[model samples]
Target: MKTIRLFSVLLFALSLSSALSQAAKPATVSVNRIGDGPIITPELDQRMGGNIQGPSLIKVPKWIENPIGQYYLYFADHRGEYIRMAYA
Candidate 1:
């Protein structure tokens, strides 16, 4: 009876630990964009710390103005897009 109780306690502890670890994990945010071609702007580069590489996802708002020039692009959330640019 004592052995069974110990086993049960150990299993409970293990399960609790696993649940906590999973909860502590951070969530990854993905961005999606509508339309083709490149979406590069000074604002995006600034927001990304001037480094646009790897897998990036962003939610673009409608009527976005260019950070460098007077231009606008339609953007929305939950859209996947690719941005390849270099900062100098």
Candidate 2:
């Protein structure tokens, strides 16, 4: 408990000092839309039915077969009747 408290106090003091030392400035960030809408939609791709769910997107590992973008999406519908995947 004593060690944890001391660590916490030290962390808090360090963070406070760092925050005080840094000057506040406006963020120089821009929002550029890659696309107006989703790449795959029910209207565009009729393969999928309604109630699409469980979308898990991940980057392909170095060992695995990487696609053009090295990323893929695993998705299923609400009923989970079928699982579909798309790579880019």
Candidate 3:
């Protein structure tokens, strides 16, 4: 009984440490853009809007810090027809 209790405790401790280590790592995401050509600027892209074609997927590090303000980083995805947005 004592040996079983000690093993259980050790197993729990190991699991907790593993979880903590994984949690400590920064989050990441994949960015996918479906377009033919790259837009030169945000303003131009907004004005012209989806003038390009083709599809691309990029994996990049996620932003860790969010500023203390009203503005926030919004994530989005869309098909040629519909759009979606999420607050981070």
Error of 3 at 71 (Å): 6.1
In candidate 3, position 25 carries an lDDT of: 61
Expressed as tens digits, the lDDT of each residue in 1-88 for candidate 3 is 9999999999999999999888866679666787977433234436325433333322234554553433333322233542322122
Model 1, span 1-88: residue lDDT tens: 9999999999999999999887856779675777885565446545444443343433344466544333334433223344343321
Order of quality (lDDT): 2, 1, 3
Cα RMSD of all models vs. native, in order, equals 12.3, 6.2, 13.5
Evaluated at residue 38, the lDDT of candidate 2 is 64
* Alpha carbon deviation, residue 10, candidate 2 (Å): 19
Q: Provide the overall lDDT of each model, using Cα atoms, as 2-decimal numbers.
A: 0.53, 0.79, 0.49
Q: lDDT tens digits, residues 1-88, model 2?
A: 9999999999999999999889688789765779798655667467687678877878788787635668888888788688888887
Q: Model 3 scores what on Cα lDDT?
A: 0.49
Highest-scoring model, TM-score = 2
